[model samples]
Target: MTDTLETQPLDRAPATPEDLFAFLDAHGIRTTTVSHPPLFTVEDSKALRGELPGGHCKNLFLKDKKNRLWLVVALEDTAVDLKTLDRRIGSARLSFGRPELLWETLGVRPGAVTPFSVLNDREHLVTVVLERAMTAHELLNYHPLINDRTTAIRSADLLRFLRATGHEPEIVDLGPPSGS
Candidate 1:
């Protein structure tokens, strides 16, 4: 199964947003799908948002002093303070990871960060985190290994994917942004 996933490449896939959905379905995954324009960051997602049919998500990759890495996914507009997040997560030093690790662990590059990339985490070293508040939403949208597209899946399946990775995520609900 791991080999199947690793060797499978959709590099020449069509430019349509459904590429992610088709990839999931071919693997027997059943989740709702939403399409949107290609995005590089949460802010870049704005223009492609409005018509989106599900919850917006932000995928972050961080590293601690010990060189331990983490992937934190939260609501799109959520304001994340690394200082507070480090304290809450017990990470001695939490800083954004470089693009290389994103590819090493998740088989994805910088702009394509997403929890779904856990599919390629054979070593299972990267930690997963989620802001508690996003659970209130029914579904969430995220990249599917390739940045040229996006995917929408049930909130439960997102959680399931995290668990299936054999890593217990550090979940939190940071009240809100400190200032307006």
Candidate 2:
């Protein structure tokens, strides 16, 4: 007999930034986006993002020893020590996922990792982790599947979007940076 799982078809093509926006609109999730020079780091973003107000964020794509994947979304200034985070997240030792793995799973490059990228993970392979403090902000800003723009959405709307995409994110209080 043939294995039913093995015979299943692959996931559909990944969603583009436009597609993501459309999805949000269809769900009645309001958002605002600003275009600017491509930003590859938090420092770059801070320097160029004039007066945008919100809890700007940084995303980490990680892989644990057991090969499980995680997407961590936190405030740009938050210090995420994988050494301690691994324990709190209940995972084996965690390390940065490779560029290829990031692309394969999230359909985005290193500089464009965002909670929005989870739109591309149709198979639900990554567990999303939201920093508790970050969620306290009224609004959150992130790249919209690309590095050349930033999008702002409500904190409640972010949770709404993630759940809409089949991801019930884990909200964790990743307390102060070590030795702060």
Candidate 3:
């Protein structure tokens, strides 16, 4: 008899918020999600922060001079020197990626960018940058593929999930460059 069962391709289909939860469960990563009004800015999210314990993140979807893409996940209060960030990540020069590209590559809108979105990047086109300090925290919070909710998970589990999605992120000290 021939083996006829075919496994589904993991990266072919875009992942939705629901899919993200299933992915987390499959990886045995425990998470807590809190629902609230859509948050587009850090200030807007502040109201919900008090209820959640852990480090909150602000994710940036950026592109380099060569058109290489990067997803930067940093602590909400961390001061990121964009002009000097390229030196650490080794990108030509960096600027926020176009909204269209962000959606297409990460399957998220502007306010919804999160490291979890790497699951939608079947081609693994976007490089992930994680702030070292942020990862040191016990728990980290980010949107679960959507802006209307926040999901909190163990910092280490976040890395595990990213690796499971084929994105071995570059964990760097996001401290401002010395000369900056």
Candidate 4:
């Protein structure tokens, strides 16, 4: 008898932004996707920053006791004290969103959280919080709805994605860097 061969079918659909460049292209949104080993933290994002093009961001999801969800996007190098951010965002206390909440709300993992995930926010329940300083930059980068890959996109195009996703973002001043 001939040897039998077994292959594993893809466990997950190639629906995430990383796997679907055509989605953005269809919308006339041009971007560059770069594959990195895997980065879980901003410091980690920083490590691979040189290899990637465009500015990077750190994303945070917070909730108020009332069950209100907030998405915070900030410059990767900026130091934000969540304790202080709590007041700015008008929340009880700012903390990382539970893994379940992340999946439920954005259909993403803890380390893979990105504003792009907002596409899955069907209810439009999450309010985006952006750093006012971001407007000064022409481009911003983040995971492509998946951490395995990073996408460098025009800041304007990102806004287009948010709008198409039905997300209204709030811009706030982050004051100054921790020591500054």
lDDT of each: 0.70, 0.89, 0.86, 0.74
Ranking the candidates on TM-score from highest down gives: 2, 3, 4, 1
Across 1-180, the per-residue lDDT of candidate 4 in tens digits comes to 011101222234324674346667777888887777888988887876576656778898877655677899988766888778878867666667677776767777888888888877776778898887774578888888778788888888888878877887778887764466
RMSD of 1: 5.9
Q: Which candidate has the highest lDDT of all? A: 2
TM-score of 1: 0.79
At residue 90, give the lDDT of candidate 1: 75
Each candidate's number of clashing pairs is: 0, 0, 0, 0
For candidate 4, report its TM-score: 0.83
Candidate 3, lDDT over the whole model: 0.86
Tens-digit lDDT track for model 3 on 133-176? Answer: 99999999999988999999999999999999999999999995
Clashes (candidate 4): 0
By the TM-score metric, which is better: model 1 or model 2?
A: 2
Q: Across residues 1-180, which tens digit of lDDT does each residue of candidate 1 receive?
A: 132333334333222335445555664656754456667987888776667677788888888777777888888878888887888777767888776656655667788888877666656667888888876688788876776566678777777666765666778785563354
TM-score of each candidate? 0.79, 0.92, 0.89, 0.83
Q: Candidate 2 or 4, higher lDDT?
A: 2
